[model samples]
Structure formats: C-alpha cells, structure tokens
Target: MGLILTEDQLILRDMAKSFFDEKSPVERMRALRDSRDAVGFSRDLWKEMGELGWIGILFPESVGGADMGYGELGVVLGECGRVLAPEPFMSTVLLGGNAILLGGNEPLQKELLPDVCSGNRILSLAFQERGRFAPYAIETKAKRDGDHYTITGRKSFVLDGHVADQIVVAARTAGSSGEREGLSLFVVEADAPGLTIHRDDLVDGRNGAHLVLENVAVDGARVLGTVDAGADVLDAVFNRATVGLCAEMVGSFEEAFERTLEYLKTREQFGVKIGTFQALRHRIANLFAEMEFTRSIVRDAQTAIDEGRNDIAEATSAAKARCSEVAPLIAGEAVQMHGGIGMTDEEEIGLFFKRLKAAELSLGDAIFHRNRFAHLRGY
Candidate 1:
C-alpha cells in the first residue's frame, strides 16, 4: 500500500528504514537469542535511537519531543518490524510512555517525559492479569494510605517488566474486577521493596515478566490522573498502542509476503520455478491483497489518532482486528510456501512468523478487537 506521504514523512520513513537495517537487523535478534541476552535488547542501540529523536516523535515539543504525530511514529515502528528489531520501543514508547503522557499530571509529565524521551529510563505497563487482554479486568488493589498508596496484585505478561525502571500499574481502588469505574493507574518503581519481577522469554525472542506487587508503596504524587478514573486513560493508551501494533504487524506481514515471493521465484520444483505455478501465483496474489488492505486500515487508524477524531476507538479496533486476523495468515502461508526450511530456527521466515504471532496476541487478538469494535459501534 503506497501511502501519500509528505516530504517529512517520507524522509522519516527512509531514515528509520536505513537505521534499523544497519543497526538492528533480524540477524541481531538471532544473535541475541543465541547468546541468551538477559536484557533482550541493546541499551546502546536504544540510546542511539533516542539520539536520533525516534522515541520523541509522538510527543509534544514541550516534553522534549519532536511534536510529531502517531503517523510518523507508525512509520518508524513499521521499519522496526521489517527487521524484527528487538528493542523496547513498543513497550516503552507506545504503552508506558503513552500512559504517562495521557494520564499523568503536568508535573509528573515534566519529570518523566524527558527521561523517557532521552532513553535514560525504561518503563512498562503492568495491567494484564490472568493472561487476559481486557484492560478493565484488573484484579490488583491499590489501597489509599494517608499520603501514599499500597498496591498488592500480580500482573501477568507485562511487556518490559523485567528491565523497566518504572512500571505503570492498573489497580482497583474501589470497583470490582471487570468494572471500569474504580480502576486507577500508579507509577511503581521496579525496585520497590515488596515488588517481584519474574522474567520470562517469550517465543518471539523477546523478554516479558510477571509482576507481583505485595504491598508495594507508592507516593500519592505517583498516581496517574484521578484515583478512580483510570479506565478512560487505559482506553486511550490501549487504542493508541493497538494502532502502533497494527502498524508493526503490517510491516511484518508485508516482509513475510515479500520473502515468500522471492523464494517462489527462485525455488524450483519439477524443473520450473514455483512462481510459475498458477496455484502459487493465485495464493500470492491473495496474500498481497490482504497485506495492502491491512496497511490501509493501519494508515487510517494512525490518522484518526493524529487528528483526535471522534471515531478513533472504532478505527483503532478495526485496524487492530484486521491486522491480527491477516498477520498470522500471511505468516503461516509464507512458511507453508517455503516448505520445511521456513520452520527451522536458522530460517529468517521462522523469526518473522514468531514475531507476527506475538503481535497477533499482544494487546488483543482478532476476536477480542472484533468484539470491542462491535460494542463500540452500539451493536
């Protein structure tokens, strides 16, 4: 899908593509996995990305950002996905950073955003519990103390919990599980006395952690937004994060499709290239169509976020659902078309497949987003 990019957008996209291709290629992920890197990504690369101003693309200039929109950020994410760049970009910038930017008070923003923008701090959002995608299904409890809050709960599948300097946690201050009204977000230091982080390496060669908070104390000033109004903040953050994930999925599936096409052109069967077969050609054509459709949906979602449109929720859900649905399909078909080698650890296609699978199940799967979309549309 050829997006009508402005000069700056084109320049940004090209720059990102060049940087990731040179600095953090798919080969880098393979290296990380082979060496069993505990950190899962390079701090040097992250700082370099910060120096390039990629981390600040979506924020305002007042907070040390470039004052760019989600569209520009999406462009960078797409390039990262293309090479399966193993960085905390999505977890830190999209999830944790957005949570703070949207939900934190002005003072909190001034204190945190600069560090985040400079890559001096790593942050993660700890909201998921019971392995569920529903943001309101929070079981963590944050009891209000005299001048602080004591949080007690376990958060599963926190994106960067293992290495985060700070974590944004959603806990029920008043409401029951699955109820939206009583949820609250708090910034908890990863080294808090009663907090425990159980790191787990995901199948995609990325690191995640299960966070256990046992009476973890947080200052009152660490609360993000109102005490019992975090549902709105979570909703906004998830929607933007979903769009960013969709953008990455688009890049991933497109690359998978391209790699499959190249394989077909060269891998011969019965004395002729597989690309010469009508059946394979038809399948490739279908996959190409799906990729383009997913790209358009992602572009629309990014634009909706940038414009602050009334239908941002609906658009984001649609984009996420469509991307989730098609990404796995493309990845699976790419593997199948490549025969046995595609499944091997040495094959790059397998890595892309794993990454796509992770993205498919990340914020929400297709079924989850489809239901959310229907509910948002008054269905």
Candidate 2:
C-alpha cells in the first residue's frame, strides 16, 4: 500500500507548523507557562487557529464544522505536539467535540458547535472520576425528574474542565439491565447552579479539575444520544481521543529526538562532541529509529480511523501503548544527555521532558492501553 500523505494534508501540516513558529515561539510558551493561569492557552492564538479552520477540522460541515477527516486533523495535532502550543485542542476539539458530533442531536450541535468552532467557548468531557479512568465505571448518577434530570456526581482529572463553558458528563441513568443499559451522557452549563469546580495543579502546569455536581439540574433536552445507550458514545469519543493522543506522541517523540540529537552535536565532553562517542551515538540512533516506527504506526491508526475500520480500536491501543512506553524513554534520555543543564528550568529540554512524561501518562498509559489491546484482541 502506498503510504503517501495527500498533497493537501501535507500542505495543511506545513501551514500549521509555520503558523506556530511565527506566532507561538518558545518565548510565548514560557511566558504562558509562568502566568498565574497556566491553562497555558493564548486566546488570540486560539482565535487565529480557529480562523484557520483547525478547531473544527474534523467536524461535519453541516453544523459549521469543516467535515475534514482525522488524517488531516492528526496533522494539525502533530504540529502542536512538535511546538508545544499550549491550547486545549485535544481535550476540547478532539475529545469533547467528538462526543457532541457523534451523540448530540442536530439542535444541540447547532446550539454548541458554533461557539466551539469559533473558539468563543471551550467544552470538556467530564467522565473520569477520582482514581477511576474507565469510563464505564461511572460513579456519577442522574435521576429522572418529570421533564428534566437532576445530576449529582464528582468527576476528576478533566482536561480543561475548570475553564470550560460546558461539560458533557457521563453518569448512570439506569441499572445494569443485563443489556448494557447503565450509562448516559448529559450536557450541562459550566456555571449551572449547584455545580462546583475544583482546579488541580498538574505536573505540566496544565488545567484540570475535580467537579462536584450537587443537585445540578438541567433540562431533559441536554441528554445526548439515545438515553440508556451512551456506551457507544463513550466508545467513539474515547477511541478517537486515544488515537489522537497517539498522533501527538509521534510528534513529541520526533521533536524530543531531534532536540537531544542537537544537544549531542554541540555539548562537548572530553574535548569532543558527545555525539561522536559510539555508545551515545548508538542510543540516539536507536531513538531516532523508534520515532520513525512510531510515526508509521500512528499514521496507520489514523488512516484506519478515517476509514471507519474496526481494526482502529485495537491498532490504536497498540500504537498508544508503544508510544507511551517509548516517549518517556526518549524524553528521559534526552534529559540525561544534557547532563546538569537538562534538569534545570533554564533549559527548554526539561520542559519537553516534562510534557512528554505528562503525555505518556494521560488518556491511557502503556499499561492501560495494553489492557485495552488485549480486550480488543479477544473480540
């Protein structure tokens, strides 16, 4: 099979890379990282990105989305990973955005998609709970009350949950009916009464939160997808999210490899560049080889997803597992190669290492993804 990216997709990726280089340089990233609100996003840059049709690149055109496929979308995310542009693109545009596109009705999409597409509002999928990463193990509950639903639950580790204007919560609407009938998704305003957000400081200084829904009330219209049939919604949203992160890790892997290689070439030891040593050179070369392999696997998953193949679920986990394990290995080595300066905050290598570590742990880490891969194999 030919493994060539379409000309348009390649162009899109280059434009995205150039866009970040021109506007979101290392200086801007550092400035935003040190700010009081390290949600680490630049609204103006987000607006520019949205205007570039990056936010809703995969959204259906009917509801103000570009209707682009995931291959194109993956390219943009890949560029973000390369540059460390600090916007919640994956959490909002990729994860939460996919939930609405797949499970939301036309009216709900019309009501919300425009704001998200325009970068005027951000949305997050509030699914995970404290110490719970599996979407099916929802501790949150929604009780039916005549014409509306009253929700009460707690969700933790929601990416950008603290700052989002809207949140899609996965809660149990019914008991396990022997027929996979326990989960439901509800859209609630972020500022709804009885809703409290507890922001947490993550390792990478990104914005995440613990949400407490104490008698949060909303209209029945907010229920997304078919009631009592949200398992598919979660499946679709999560599979896409997992796959998207794999693509980003590919970018992270490549950039961290190159950065470390740069260090090897310039950083002198024993009167010669450290890279000239056979052992260190071999290590960097192995990492380079792994990065290329990672890119191939992620692209294969992306193509599968775009083609709507069942192979995507299993292959995605495989790719994520490999990347998660390999990315941190690459990042840690990159840091080690820099010696003392790598551990110091003054160097950008430390930041890349920190983010790479964070990315490795997010969504599903190597262990988590391997389990998923095992389950998918039996199916």
Candidate 3:
C-alpha cells in the first residue's frame, strides 16, 4: 500500500515537529532527567499540547477531539520521537486513553474523556506481571464482593504509574493463569487505598513504577467493558499501542540515522571525512535500507489499523518485531561509526542509543514478537 500522507496529515506532522522543536527539545529531556521531575514530564507542556488538540488525536468528535485516525496520531508520535521529547503521550494518550475508549461504557467515556483530552487527567496501563508480555499470563486477581471487588496482586513496569490520575489494570476474574478466558480490566484511582507505587528511573530518561495492590477495593462502576469478557478489549488496546510504539521507533531510527550521517560528513578521520570511507558508506547504506524497510512496515501497520483490517494483530506484531530488530542495529552502527565520542554522555547519539534500547524491550522485544507472529499464524 502507498504510505503517502494526506494534506491534513502533512500539516499535522509539521505542526507536531515544530511544536516539539520549540517547546520540548533534547535539552528539556536532559533537564527533566537531571532534576528527577516527580511527574517525569512537563505538565505545562502537556497542557499546552492538549490546548493545541494533540492529546485528542484519536478520540471521537463528541469527546472534544479532532476526529482524526491513528495514522495522524502516528505522524505526531513519530515527530515526538525524533527529538526524544519526554512526555507520557504514549502511556497517557495511546495506552491509557485508548483503553477507556475501547472498553469504557458511554457514561464512563462522558465522565473521563473530556478531562483526558484537556490534559486535566493522566492515565496509564498496569498489565504486566513478573515481566511477562503474554496478555493471558495474568496473575492479578480481582475477587468480587457485594457491588465491589478486592484486587490483590503486583504489577511491574507500569508505564507512568507513579503519576497517573488513573490506571487501567488487568486481572483474572474467572480463569486460571495463562488462560484467555475470564480476564477483565478495571480503572483504579492512582491513590486508592491499599495501592503502593514504587518509581524507578529508567536508562532512557523516563520513569515507570511497580504497583502492589493489597486488597484494593474498586467499585463495580470501575469495571471496563463486560465483567469477565475483557480479553478482546485488552487485546485491541495492546495491538494498537504496539503499533503506536513502532511509529515512535521509526522516528527514533530516522533521527539517529540522520544524526549519524551528519556526523560522518563532518567528523574527520585520516585528514578526510569518515563518510567518504567505502566501508562506512556501505554500513550507512545498509542502515538506510533497514530504516526504509521498518518505515514501510510501520506505515502498513498503522494503515491497517486505520482501515480496520482483520489482520491488524499480525501486521502490528510484524511491524513491532521488525522495528525491535532494526532499532538496536541502527543504534549500534551509529555509535560505532561515531567512534569514541559516541560512548560519552556528552554526545547526543548515546541518548538515542539508550532510547532505542528501551523501545526494543518496551512492549515486546524482537524475539517475543517473532514468536507471537508465528503463533498468530498457528506455527
């Protein structure tokens, strides 16, 4: 399929690029990292983005959104990744906001989505347990009581969990661990009783947390979608989020490649530009080819989602797996080509390398997605 953007999409992409370039640059990320910001991002900037209608890119028109598709949102996210801008757009907007949209009832949507669009609320997903990426490998249990449920389990690597206003949690409502049946999703307040959040600083200048729920009580109204039929909702959310992540990886890869190429042209070796060397040129060529391939896959995945294709899951897994494999390759080649300076914190390339490493492991690594792809095909 052709991956060309429409006029409006092109405008949106340019607007996002300019906005990030002016508002949240690499220096902003460095400052956030050094200060160990409690929120791990700039709320002021987030609000400004909300005011600019970026936070509502995927929501429907009734909810104060621009009524755009995932492709438009992908364009914006790709630009955000180019600068390594530190914000919770992925966690808050893509993962959290999408969870509600996909699973929440009409009343819940009416209550929450406007705040989400206006940046008055932050949301996150707490799904993984024991480092497992399988959607069905949930051990978190939510025991039902009279019009309520008591959640008891631990969630690890919850994105933006430390500062989110709400978190969408996955728990086993009726099935055994690793079973696809009887899974459910619930939105719990971040500061709810019996909940403890422990924040950890990540190498990529972001923050995540481990959440422990000790008899945490949630009202029946907090349940998202049907009581014990949330597997499809969770699956839809994950697949979309994975595709979104792949879009961000595409941006990172493109920027890293661009920076490495610029370095090659300017950096001197043996009284000549390193880019002139045949060996390094071939490596650059190969990196460029891999980037193009990853870009195509990402676009295909996003387009599949926008078109509501039946094969979206397989396409998303393929895109994410391809991006996972190529991100590290591009980062490694960029670092090696840049020589000793690339290893230092003072160099910008190192930041890209760290971000790529984080992305490679975030949703599912290349190996994980490869296995998932095979499984999806009944291999």
Candidate 4:
C-alpha cells in the first residue's frame, strides 16, 4: 500500500533523502567507526539542513521551526535512517529540542532553540540510568540549594552525549513511593563544573555517553518544567521520540528489504536466479506483507500523535513493538538470503544489517514496547 504522505511531507522526505544520499554514505559512516567520539555527519551538510529549517520541522514557525507535524518529521526521519545519518536527529531535534517546546521557560527557549535550529549547537537527553527503559526509575538526584540545584548521580546511554552543547536531564526529587511526584527535568550545560562525560559507542556505531554528576550545580534558570512536576512533560518528549524512532526503523527495514530483493534478482543458484525460486519468493512476499503492516502501524501512530489523540501511548507502543520485531526479522532474512556475502563489512547490505540490529533496541526495544502495549490495554 502507498503511504499517506501529503505533498509537503513528500517534499520533506525527498529533501532528507537527497541530503542523506549525498552526505552520509555507508563509507562515510564506516570511516568514523574508529574515531573515539561522535559519528556525526559533515558540518557543511548539517548547516544545509539548518538552512532548510528541517531541524525544527515540528516546532512552531514563530520559534524558527517549519511547524510541520510528525507526518513530515517521520518521513524525514525515515530518510535519515536510510543512510544512518549520525547527526543526532532524534537526540537533538526530537528529544532535547522537544522538551523546550513542551515545557521550557520562554527565556530558555529564546536563548537555546535558535542556535539549536541553526545546527550551531548540539544537544541530547540525559534521562536514563542503568535501567533506561524505566522512565520513573531514576536514582539521579537534583536537590534545590540556595539559588540553584545540585545534581548527584549517573545517567547512562545518553545519545550524542559527549558532543552535546547541552543535556536535558531527568532527576528525582522525591521518594519512589510517589514516583511521578517530586521528579523533574533540567537543562544542564555540557561543561558544567561538576559534570564528567564518558563516551561509549553503541552497537549502531553511534557515540553514546554516560554522564556522571558529582554535585553538578545548576542555576535556577536551568530548570525545564515546574519543580517536581516533570513526569508528564518527559512523557511527551519520549512519545515524540518513539514516533520518530519508528519512522527511522521503518526506513532501515525498507532499505534492507529492497536491497535483499535486488540481490535475489541477481544471484544465481543451480544456474537460476534465486528470485525465481518459489520457496524464497514466498518468503520474500511474506516479509513484504509484514513490513507493510508495520508501515501502517507507524502511519497510524504518527497520525494519532499529530492530532493530539489521547491514545498516544497505545499507538506509540504498537508502532515501536511492530518495528522492533519486524525490522530485525526482515534484516536477518535479508542477510540469510544474501548468504556469506552479506556478512562482510565491505558489502553495503551488511551495513544496513548492522544498523537494523542497532535500531532493534533503541529507545525501548521490542519487549519493552510490548509490555507497554499490554499496560496501555489495561493488562
């Protein structure tokens, strides 16, 4: 089935596809694998994206964004995923940038968002700990002091952490008995005195970091939302992130599927092309059906969120869960059908496989999303 994209969204996807095709080729990504820090895209390309105003596709036009909804953002994210652009779109654009729009103070938005929109500033989320999948399981503390808050604890798996100019952090200020109560999110400067950043490369070849806050102090102006009332806003940020991630994963799977199909059309076994084999063709058709179903799931989820529907949790969980399962399955079959050649890094198909595996666990993964789906269904 065809996608339900408007001409504007199609234009956004086309723009992103052109940028990714030019700037983030697989060879470019492989070159950055050995680098100690980030696997980001070209600076000039990033500036071009900024000039296009795509960095703020979902933000209000008043705030330097294009004011497009997730429909367009999802399409763009899909294009980003196709090439595995390492420019921290989800971390900066979808998560850190979104928090400002959802709950940041007017001054904070004015001070930070303009630079972010221009791609001059890199930002990311410092929201999880050892247990990233649990949103309310934070042990990080940000206690109010005289004119600031002192944070003490660790946040792990921060996307684009070491390279970020700013980090949006989530910390707990109250007891677990009242989980959501007394929790808060804050915007911490990357170079804040008491902060230490340790970078780790994720399975996807992206630079992720674990931030250690040894009594890192933040001024009163750094608080993101009302003190002890950040849970809802954080939920919104993740919801947006989830929807965007679904798009990315879908793109990855889409490319992998197409690549595999092309391979089947070319590879000969027993003097015949594999695509002519009835058994393999049936399998490929089955994968396509499942993938198209997932496409519908992601589309409906994006539409629900874009329309401010109350069933966002349910829709997002369904989309993420479907993606988590289907992407890996499709990628694995793509590799299997390609045989030994798919295992080599020299082959572009292998790169897509690696990226697909990485996307499998991003944000929440299949199991987590499945459980969330159950919870939303009142199980």
Residue-by-residue lDDT tens digits, candidate 1, 256-278: 99999999999988999999999
List candidate 2 segments past 4 Å from native. 176-181
lDDT of every predicted structure (CA atoms): 0.90, 0.82, 0.89, 0.84
- Rank ordering of all candidates by lDDT, starting from the highest: 1, 3, 4, 2
- Per-residue lDDT tens digits for candidate 2, residues 1-379, read 2245798988998898899788877667777768756455787788778888888888877766798877888888888888777788877887788888889988999998987887888889988875525557776889999989999988888888878888898888887422347889998899999999988766765778899999899899988887889888888888788878877777776887888898899988899999899989889888888877877877888888888887978878888888898999899999899899889998887777888878887777888889989997995
Candidate order, TM-score descending: 1, 3, 2, 4
Judged by whole-model lDDT over C-alpha atoms, candidate 3 comes out at 0.89
Q: How accurate is candidate 2 locally (lDDT)?
A: 0.82
Q: Estimate each model's TM-score.
A: 0.98, 0.95, 0.97, 0.95
Clashes of 1: 0
Pick by lDDT: 2 or 4, better one: 4
Writing each residue's lDDT as its tens digit, candidate 4 over 236-348 gives 88888989989988988898899899999999989999999999999999999999999999999999988888999899999999998998899899999999998877777
lDDT of 3 by residue, 1-379 (tens): 3587888888889899999898878888888998888888999888888899888988987988777777888998898889998788878888889999999998988888998898889999998897646778898999999999999999988888888999999998997888988998999999899999999888999988999999999998989888788888888998999998888889988999999999999999799998899999999999999999889888999989989889998999999899999999999998998899999988988999999999888888999999989999999
Which whole-number lDDT from 0 to 100 does residue 319 have in model 2?
86
Which residue pairs show backbone clashes in model 3? none
